[model samples]
Target: WSSSLGGVRLINAYGPTETVITATCYDVPRDETLPDRFRGVPIGTANANRLLYVLDRHLNPLPPGLPGELCIGGENLAMGYHKRPDEEKKVFVPDPFRPQGRLYRTGDKVRMHGNGLIEFLGRVDQQVKIRGFRIEPGEVENILAGHPHLETALVAVKTDAHGEKQLVGYFRPRAGSRPEISEIRAFMQKQLPPYMIPAAFIELDTIPLLPGGKVNRRALPVPEDLRGQLSAEYVAPRTETEEELAAIVSSVLRIEKVGVYDNFFELGGHSMLGTQVMSQIQEKFGVEVPLRVLFENPTVDGIAAAITEALTQSIDEEELAGLLGDVTDLNDDDLNALLNDE
Candidate 1:
């Protein structure tokens, strides 16, 4: 409200150097609409005698509410930059709908929300399809930056041994602050949709930068281990129960090398996932770990110890004969579900 003390109001505007200056404007004249937040703030409707287009890959116009590359056109458009004809040719493509006219591809993905107001999603190049989900790395980065101890975040894709694409996140903590991978993951799991959550996180002293001060993405190191979450220290599973729990957790969570000390809840476990874990533990070990046990013993070491203690008391070998029937090739989840039912 301190900003309103001055008679002059602030206006949100958008344009590129190619447009010389502002070409679009957004004004929130109402006091009630004083503050507005955008995923990436929408550059409002076009300015006087300006044209904007949200188009598909083929340069065909897209319907409202659909995200596509933004194209700019109008009399306000400037000619090609000096000694930059090659770069200009790439963006200044021929507009099919407008005879002999050209449109500047902005490389920005945006959607029309309501009326003619367009909301910026992210850069078109930043959008990647993961498991059929169109993921904006900036969206994931935004969630990571929301972490209490984080100073900044970056999300990018990497392929593993089999050439499967995976989302990996890199982060830097605030000065003199240390945060665990589980803590950051828990924060992200709560904030972002599951598909958008990075499968792995890597902490960095600093994000690699190019000579021009842009991110040198090509320089990001490929993690050899490919663990779901990278920890500063390596702790292995000790007991057989711990090992099984580690394997099950890693498989179920799509993470790699879960240690005995890792907390399930911190590793993106919710109530539904807790139920599956309980059932799987029951089937695999032929032991019934009550659902409440998960909350009490959330860590691998604690949960494995509790499972061992339970098996020691309820060693019903005769009942196990029938319950363990034909489990030769059953998957972990199915086997656990079957055993839990018995």
Candidate 2:
């Protein structure tokens, strides 16, 4: 029977001459519904006197949901491989708990998903961490697949020169139609939290498949190399006074000298930072800009010009002072006196 279509907990045993008659067996359940591309569980007992321990980097047993590497220990553990003692030494580690014994470090990363179920995450080498958060690309891809319009999606992490990591997603449309970037962004917004969402989305006609008939994530195209990849890039600053406003944004945002061609949120800016940028722009430019300015200009140069324009068209000093004074007096506690045409 074919591997994927089979409805049996099949176990095939094979091994090399030195490894002895294969003592390991992988269990594939009948009609196992492994979501996405997750494989089935492993089926191997502690051969007589062996031990299996799943541990984190700190050698402590991880909680059920937390992922960790699997270590195998016991008398059944193999001896040194040929004259490659150094290579053997790296794979075989001395167990801290068990005295006078070593364990083979299987590079597999897995999570105990409870109820006697252990879920394989991926290889430890493939795990990518960002901002002190351990992330599995498969988990993000699975979340994206939950969207109604998205037929399939794959997620990967891109690292810049400064060692900063960002998530990028590649997806195929359900039908023979092209989906707008805005629509995909909005759809992801509803399904995932901000950190989990892809910083950039790339739509494709089909996901590349490997020779083994699995999604070839490594072959996915990279995100476009847009100069200003943020929301601040689209708007252009219009006035000279706005030019000065751009300086303040460049200082606070710490970006590479922003211009009208840049974008605010696309430069990895957030709502809180937007408020600070706006406040500084208002103070330095002597103008009160709206919170919507960030969404409108989204770039230092653009926001500066917006402030300058708003200032130029604003009311004169006398009218402004009168308005302020009226507001101040209106707050006084003589309600009846004030209401009686005071």
Candidate 3:
């Protein structure tokens, strides 16, 4: 697009309010193709009299290609926030790299390219921990943006009715496209591991944006119910085992209904919750079920089948134990006769 402007130069500027204006600038090259790994345009190197440092949580400098919190130092930084001492202390701190300067933590996650250009990953606060896995929503959003049916996508961590944190994907479908939640879910499954997948996907006509054109996360509607997010259509439990298994899954997930084909992980089930489900199954069925059984067969029907098999094995073991006990009590002549019969 810049090529059409003739002598015009397109510049990408990046800075936080605390930086007292633009701290970095990138002269976007015309007709330049960015590598596939870069999620967005590079914010470029620091401007004159400005210092940019990408550091980890411990204030240690991170190597290039590693995402970390962006800290701005040197003459461009503000003198902390007014009348907000507590908040100021958290973000503005002494620079570890310099002897006489302070760095304002931008709370922006970014990584430096090998060529020294800085690429913005996302906001540090947007990173979330779900099911023991720390996830950057921007990473998932980047993958979602590649889907042919989606025009744009945003992922955020939302608390469900049960007070559990879940990743919910909000997306706008491409023009003239009405993509199903199941199709989106399948696309995500192919690109990401189970833990990285969003628990629910909501279709939005237009994602709310602030005046600056950034996503207005607070404006995104809370899903009234998550049943619509399931990849499979709701099918009520038909068998006694299915009914029991469905009850367990519903209780664990804090969702009202579970279907025979509904996947456990897709319904927000994780390793911790899977353990609880397995424990309850063992107590109810009086048989041991391995943890991997849930991962292999996450649906209610699949779990019910595992439980049924476990129960059958238990019964068979008991019958074998009884036969052994009878043999133990047999006299020497009877034992010999039994051996001969066998």
lDDT tens digits, residue span 1-342, model 1: 436565566567977777657867877453544223344445788898778898998998888888898788878777876899999988888877788777888887777765888876668888788666778887677667657688877778887555656687888899988998778877886777666777678888978999999888778766555444633245798777788888887776666677776666545454567788888888799888887777787778888889888876776765676566757668999889987999
- Worst 10-residue lDDT window for candidate 3 reads 222-231
What is the per-residue lDDT of model 3 for residues 255-296, given as tens digits with 9 covering 90 to 100?
Answer: 778999998987888889999999999888888899999999
Q: Please state the error at residue 66 of candidate 2 in Å.
A: 2.2
Ranking by TM-score: 3, 1, 2
Per-model lDDT: 0.75, 0.64, 0.88
Error in Å for residue 287 of model 1: 16
Which candidate comes out best when scored by lDDT?
3
* Stretches > 4 Å off in candidate 1: 1-22, 25-37, 41-45, 58-65, 78-101, 115-117, 129-134, 146-149, 159-164, 174-180, 221-342
For each candidate, C-alpha RMSD in Å?
10.4, 7.9, 2.9
How does residue 80 of candidate 3 score in lDDT?
A: 80
* Model 1 Cα shift for residue 78 (angstroms): 4.9
Model 2 over residues 133-241: C-alpha lDDT tens digits? 5667776776676566767777888764445676787877778657666576667666665556676777777778899899776777766553434433345446666
- Candidate 1 vs 2: which has more TM-score: 1
User: How many clashes does the backbone of model 1 have?
Assistant: 1
